[model samples]
Target: MRNSRPIILFPLLCFLSSTISILCEPNTLVCNEKEKHALLRFKKALSDPGNRLSSWSVNQDCCRWEAVRCNNVTGRVVELHLGNPYDGFDLEFYRKFKLGGEISPALLELEFLSYLNLSWNDFGGIPIPSFLGSMGSLRYLDLSYAGFGGLVPHQLGNLSTLRHLDLGDNSGLLYVENLGWISHLAFLKYLGMNGVDLHREVHWLESVSMLPSLSELHLSECELDSNMTSSLGTISEVHFTALSKLKVLWISGTSLSFHVNSSIPTSGSGRGFLSGIVDTAPNWFWKFASYIVWIDLSNNQISGDLSQVVLKNTFIDLSSNCFSGRLPRLSPNVRILNIAKFILGTDFPFHVQKMNGRSKLEVLDVGLCGA
Candidate 1:
């Protein structure tokens, strides 16, 4: 008891001092000077009628600015998330929060910017800045639904470190005439180019094949032609082993040749039958699609059986297609099946029995299937 009181008091005092130090810390860390200037320059270039950028000012740290995130340790800008977050309650919110302006090249000053999302804004139909391609450290780049019109800068392919790139839904304005440059993105995993005009890109498939690390691909409504008829003959046997990492593929609304339940005849000397669509028919396609978790081939002219080749534990959408014959065999882990308007030529009783047994199917849309 002689010194216990003094020891307890000393420990309490140390704890209080540490607590006070942490509590007195600044609310937001100070951002880098050059990055702050770059952001201010970007604000000056934009027309923010809704005062969306009011928080951005010289009096405040740029790290605390709206749609900006900086690394706490280094005070370097790491993310710029500007524009309407599409929450789906209000589709027109993009119009309200749309920042209309010329994208300032001053953004190049943020050397550490790894994530930049300018989606759902209004850029006045300008071509995407080619300088963005020089940002080698960028991991996520999304300019979707931003009213960007004109040729997509081939320089974007220079982002070899990019993991996710979404330039989708620009209202048929963006076009990539040459896709060979995309081959340079060796580390790319996810790509969404929905609604972009790719009708003229004959080599899109071949170019995409070069990306060995691609896991998810979305090219819906791109107006791609069904010109793989000649190649289909040779494709069945050709080992597409390089696309082993593909997990999600969406080709809805494209004009690709899809063989449904019918077997595709091959012309080569060692000819064999191709069972179904490219997702399952070709030996390579089926092998690579083993890990596919999502697949949407809706609203296409595909006529195929839902049997042998469909991926397990996947959200499958084969609606509005010419898919006939037997109801596709639902995998044990199939979670959702949208087979609406699918003309499956199977007895109603047999189909219902199979559907009823799938306990994992959380959503089953078999509407308008002429069973």
Candidate 2:
């Protein structure tokens, strides 16, 4: 009786152990059923004319679907890149893949999602979903050129872990009432809000400066305030001590009013005082020389001495402005220089020769400078 019982029990134990090992194997791991249903719900909300999400059907695993990424171990959705990837130089490819639909709030189901990109698509002028603020795990978000309308939702400030944000190039449909919310994103490094109206947001500069980790700021053509220079002087006194780690700064085509006191130098200084121009005064743009790599201050009504500020950038564009007086010498790292449509002095060639020898100076466009 004892020998018969041991034989039966040994076979049962071996069968249970083999079943447990098969269940725990990596090949058996599939996308979480809850998250998979969420993805299906998200697809249902959008009107994808291009059929970009055809592979997101029930026949396939969600992890193997287009624009979806899942954690290998936990099998949780972590990233979604639903942007029009073909919006580069290929016109045919762009027309084929561009999605036109509203972003769904169902994305909240993916609690572990860290990356989301929905740029270069047609969203039919819909407002960005406010619920995105609740996605606490988000690290990168890009909604550029998505055709969204209305004021930027203040709820986005709740994303304390966000590192990069791009809501730029949405035509004139998107804007900000104020930039106060941006101060909360302490880890934000790159902020691109180009072409969004900031005319009403007077505290734009100060609010942006509060971002300690900010490296690149692109606010070009954003209808910035006319009081930019005066605000910069004030900001320099207060936040310049805090210092900017900004590498790329683009404020071109924004109607910036340049009204500086006559105490500042307009002409070249040789340790000699001129009756007309101020001699040897510190300039605001000069302070940016050390930190910035690329700068574009072109196509504005900047009326002042061009030689007033010294910039040491790799790429500098001061074209189509009312800047007079001697040009500043280019730094050794200078590669592209555009100073077109300026009233350059007779000694403009001198600065050009100085750049030719020490710097990697290449594309120097002095067209219409009257040099």
Candidate 3:
């Protein structure tokens, strides 16, 4: 009865003040003037597709803009992804722009940037400069599926912080050599190089020995040679042994013999031992591989047992080459599998039965042995 209005109204006033403070916070995820201007410049440089970047208006806060990512803690823009296509032009419109242009260094101005994925863009003739590597904060750099050419500047090695590097499918990635230094990347989590000029030497893989934190590695279509094949001897024993954090492996290990239960296939080179050593090389390979689900050695000189290990969520491809082990029970979740040029000598001394569990199998082809 004694002026209850004052008590109710006082709390309401405090709640309203707190809301206004949050909205006007100086540390909010709003773009500063320089960042907004940088965004405007980028929009002008790109040929927007489906008006996707139409939302990139100057009135908008860049951190909230499309395809743009920001560091959640500091509220600073970090990633700028622009690659679709304009209304009228070659589907490769983005490709043409990379051929020749002044890369706005304004982007490098972002202080907290770490991951930059500029793939599928036609950036021809543009060079990966030393300044780009000095991005002391960068951890993942993916310049793949692009047309950039020229020697990979040695400065890239300076990015001591880089963890995942993908220079794949680039026409000129082969130009850079003496990459044993790249092994210096101690924090590398993933490294992919398809159609590049790195084979065997081992000094590079030896460099991997230095990276104790590495997790994933993909060296596809490298077209290995005798030296490269022999390098596997040191893979598990040396660098691979050090990868205590490794999880996935897509490698063709040393040739071994198989326990065939029937006549060997004539189409096969018959060099495979069918001794699944995927778990042998390094203890690390097997340790993390226990958690893997995807592995492919389809077109290679790989021969071994496919069912020796109980790999979960795996899609194994041991076609083309000679593989002589009996197909083991696979998880129903496996989707793709091929064992065409596969054979287990002339005797499978062990059992071959279906594994019991909730799985999803997609492909199963077994041929070439006694076929």
**Deviation in Å, model 1, residue 73 alpha carbon:** 1.4
Candidate 1 lDDT over 190-246, as tens digits, reads 899998887556667777888899989998888664443444333332324566788
lDDT of 3 by residue, 226-286 (tens): 3333444434434445666766556543231112222223343323232332221223433
Candidate 1 off by > 4 Å: 1-24, 86-92, 227-240, 258-290, 306-310, 343-358
**Sort by TM-score, best first: what order?**
1, 2, 3
TM-score of each: 0.81, 0.81, 0.68
**What C-alpha lDDT does candidate 3 achieve relative to the native structure?**
0.58
lDDT (CA) for every model shown? 0.74, 0.75, 0.58
| Superposed model 2: Cα runs more than 4 Å off | 1-29, 88-91, 227-243, 258-282, 306-310, 343-353
The whole-model C-alpha lDDT of candidate 2 against the native structure comes to 0.75
* Residue 311 alpha-carbon offset, candidate 3, angstroms: 3.6
For model 2, name the residue pairs that clash: none
Q: What is candidate 1's local distance difference test score?
A: 0.74
TM-score, structure 1 vs. true: 0.81
- Candidate 3 local lDDT, residue 344: 42
2 against 3, candidate with superior TM-score: 2
By lDDT, the best candidate is 2
lDDT of 3 at 354: 77
